[model samples]
Target: MMQQSTIIIILLSLFFLTGCWDEQLLKDVALINSQAIDYDSENDTVKLTIALVSGNSNEKVPTNTTIVSAEGKSIRDGRTELDKKVGSELFASKNQVTMFSRKLAEKDIYAALDGNYRSPLSALTARLAVIEGEAEPILHAETENKPLISDYLRDLLISAEDTGAIPSVNLQNTLTTLYDDGQDIVMPRLKTVEQKAGAKLIGTALFSDRRMTGELNSEESIILLLLANSKKGAHRMTRKVQTDEVDPLYDYVTVDVENMKRKLRVKKNELGNFEVQIDLVLKMNANEYPGDDLYKRHVIKRLNTQLSEELTKEANIVLTKIKEANCDYLAIGRQVNAFYYSDWQNIKWKDVYPTIEMKANVDVEIIYHGIIN
Candidate 1:
């Protein structure tokens, strides 16, 4: 009798745990894949746009996505307006991307993101970006091959980050940096092109205290990514070989950055000025040198030195911009806080960063010269 009762209990437990107990049916739910927020300064209102997935998941690809927008006093109020427009209740658990227009981002990013922060269903890791203009058009933009706009944008962002063209930023990273006293956030920049025919990734937008302070072009962004010692796949660049331009056979050489290591240090000099030094050790492959003699050690050494100098120059430019913006995206303040907490308490980082002495040192090695010499 005890064995029979044990078997019945086991069967009941299995039955209760078998399927989803409170799962909402797909037909009753609106799964959001992307969201965009814009602010209207004239009327003091917020605009919220969401891209919602539709159709059966049993099919290979989703059939379509519908974009809906609404305006209200705040994001929550705007969301309520959106709910009234769409028949199904909206959910952002599957959101893959979130974007804010420059106007909205500049005004107050934290205010715009308050709903997401408070909501449990919000996607904390959704890739975040800043759009050049109104963000609604980007979600509505049609594609020739790829049907889903969110998937296309997410893939493009991932590809750009992997190629070291941009720094990866998501909702979680943004919030973390915004809360941290030492670091700032950098987000990918997007722009609509040709009457919303498509979208283009312009560069990267740097934020200081949740406000858009500066931007880095694609080239500058790569240098910043390298300075940050971001791990990525091989990044390629073409540089003039210092060869005579008149009859140059190999005027330009292509270098692939296989790996890079960066070290940053903060210290006080004898003169009582704070100093920061950044050193980058880079392993590179000469993919296209054109010259047959590039395999020679001396030629390789010269190329390495030249590349190092060029990279250092670019790194300096990045540092200059970082200083100009007064945005410590490099986390130099963290070093100060850890080592010199008393000094940090007295000195204002924003004021000192502009005057601080910072230098970039790059060490490059040409690990390979391709298969054919």
Candidate 2:
């Protein structure tokens, strides 16, 4: 009994004393906050740029920064070359953003991204975006009065989320959607604009089969938000309506819109065609209603009908644009897969998708008169 107790005590002490075998200290590791990748098709080489964070506390003292660029035939080889250029081990655990040139995304971003996903040090939650021009120029742009470039990129994504124009796609989400059969992927397309001091969020990149097939402009992106039911917070919608007792010109009402919700449904017809039904419910506050004492119930009814018609027209226009782009921003296939699994499997979605019919029914309900009837 004494011998066994002594042995058990010795094992516990050994276990407690044994620290992490492969511990990496913060001082020893160079933290990468952002990475940009550019592919040169002409030379069949890839260039990678890593942005390292300089933990300098003194505001007056200028901070020292370094950019390491490497080229190789493959992404892994390029990364190895970058490691050699940096002299220190390239740690990506602190990486917050990954950017790819449009040319690279147009070719295929899977292999380049695969290496990041496979590495244990790389963060799966890093935000992903596509640079409009060369990756290196955007990566090494001069930072004048802003925070770190990585933090700025992160803020750009968060601001886009607030606008409801583009949905955030992190590294993990991008890969999962790229691999999923029922759905496709999309990423925010960023470009350095002359308007907002330096950079701006232009639009979004539409992906099909892990390759960028098309792009959605700001208006088209808003339409995508409405169709996907991803819009949140306040959105501005304007419509012109004529009053019931209208004499033509002087009876127009221009309203500022708020509180919008959209519900979508997918169903298969008897003729083996997919039909999408969209029900849009929205409320409007009266901003500019012409004429004195125009609170008649029938006037409100007529205005609602007119608003509904206009909303339907706008919705169809946006849907048509998405269809033309060959991008399923609404995830119609996902709905079909969830509801009609057998039909989805038997049908070639790519072929059937373009031919799918969409019917949008918009209902505008007036809940408030903005403290004035």
Candidate 3:
């Protein structure tokens, strides 16, 4: 009797099963590959630019992109204007990259991104960047050799993140860090190159809370990421160890970090002040060293000492920049709070962060060399 009733219930439930009610068809709406926000000082309004990806389906490269723009007071308002200009096109589930102009980023980046955070449909996974100039021009950048501006820029940023040249970040984590007192955020910086025919991932933009506090070039950015232990893949760097060498090529050495061990400590010392010490021990494989005397013990030992000093000096420079900007990408504040709550509560972090004594030491060891070496 129970089996018969179960069978009847299963058969009756199938009758009420309905199809997908929220399914959106591809042909009806355009997919946004990239979106850029710029401050229009003349109009005192925000300009929104989106690269709608529409091209040959068979080709791998994003060859064709339809550029669209709208101006309004805010991101959602701008999107509303964009909707009226192009019917049924406020969707951004497929968005890959989001860019903000340096002017806007310096002013109030949080305001520009507020709408996207509130909306559940926003592209949380999209890569974020700060543009050197108007972000829209990068979207309008035309090139014959590359894919669509959106695709090209996205790939460039992803590759940079992989190499630890830029921070791996998105809109999602940015929101969390913006409100956190412990740490600040960093985003990749982008700019047009070669007369607007192409673009380049320049470096990174340092942020305190919501506004961009400072900028770091490519090398400085890489070193910051390394010190923070935020590197994703192989950290390969070429530095001029032999500065006085006659040949430029012979002056430099290229090494790939095989393994890295980093230690960061935040302690309140006898002086009643906080101090941070970062130590990095890196094991590297030499990819290129024109002098090529790795077999000798003294040569390897000397090179090891040279690379360590060079990296430590470079790290100090970058750390000074970070401290000057008051950008706490290392989350030292969090460590202090977690470990020493009394000290954290006594001091206002914003005032103390810049004044804190911080030091970085990097030691590099070349474990192996390429065949030529």
Candidate 4:
């Protein structure tokens, strides 16, 4: 009888602790999905805008979002104002992306990212990008079938990154590169489309230290990715080639990069001349060939040779831009630190980078033509 009475007492105690004592309800929490920060340079103020999914759990898919904005002298102050603007308590743990206006990115990227680091529940893995104009406008942009702006932006970035059109940069990656001495950071650029009533990924913004130095167009961005030997899923490129007896300067052919191998080395020649050599080998598929006679051995050989030359030329152009920006995204500085410690210690890398002898040797093999060929 004593044991039974004790068991009943324990069961009754468990029932009282079943529900959360300090739990916050979903309906009373505003989950931030994305945020955009714009800076007023003259006043040294920040305009922070956030997009939050409407806490409407009744529907199968939440189709609406809320936009709230606040301005203050600092990011933390802005957050306080943001709390007053929203109906429910603000939560940032669900943030999917973060954006900065071009002016803000150029002014101080590290400052813009400070809040991300300080917040314990901040979205550390959120995608980061720079907007061409004001950052707030992106929150209100139309997102067709994709109801939420955050979902649209996330998918857009993931798609471009997978195809090697832009570099994959997130909060953690950006912070890592920004802090690393030997490397720089690159972020995708976003701009509003006036006619389409939406936004699109434009190019990529290159950063030196805490400021954006330059931008690379879509084609150049792809070339940069290629030079970095980024792992991509079915990378594709369209190049112009001279057709047989064609009067036009070139005809376009689209090729799918089936397989790629690259080797980079920094070494001193017999004459003690330092050089950086890049050896690239690509197995490609002629996905779309406008030229005639695809099966001809001479034509295949000519195409292969032209492709290799064009890639080499493109690599040179990219290197020139990289040198001009003086942003070391190629990990060349890291290589020097590892292999040429004496030289690295003796000479400043920024001064020697532009003068360094860099060469690209490209070899392309056309593994398959289209099924029609």
In order of listing, the candidates' clash counts read 0, 0, 0, 0
TM-score of each: 0.91, 0.81, 0.93, 0.90
The sequence of per-residue lDDT tens digits that candidate 2 reaches over residues 123-172 is 88898988898877666555566557777777778777776667878888
Judge candidate 3 at residue 150 and give its lDDT: 76
- Segments of candidate 1 deviating more than 4 angstroms: 7-23, 56-60, 243-250
Descending-TM-score candidate ranking:
3, 1, 4, 2
Clashes of 2: 0
- Better model by lDDT, 2 or 4? 4
Residue 57's lDDT in candidate 2: 60
lDDT of 1 by residue, 245-271 (tens): 676866778888887788998999999
In TM-score terms, candidate 4 sits at 0.90
RMSD of each candidate?
A: 2.6, 5.1, 2.5, 3.0
Which pairs, if any, clash in model 1? none
What is the lDDT for 134 in model 1? 90
For model 3, residues 1-373, the per-residue Cα lDDT tens digits are: 9999999999999999998987778768877789999998878899999988776778765568889999998888899889887766567887889999999999999999898888777889899999998899888787775557777888888988787678788888888999999999988998898677788878889988788999899888878888998648776788877764577778888988888999998887899888899999999998888877988888889889999999999999988998898899999889988998987888889899999899999999999997764
With a 3 Å backbone cut-off (N, CA, C), the pairs that clash in candidate 2 are: none
Q: Which of 2 and 3 is the better model by lDDT?
A: 3
Runs with alpha carbons beyond 4 Å of true place in candidate 3: 1-11, 55-63, 243-246
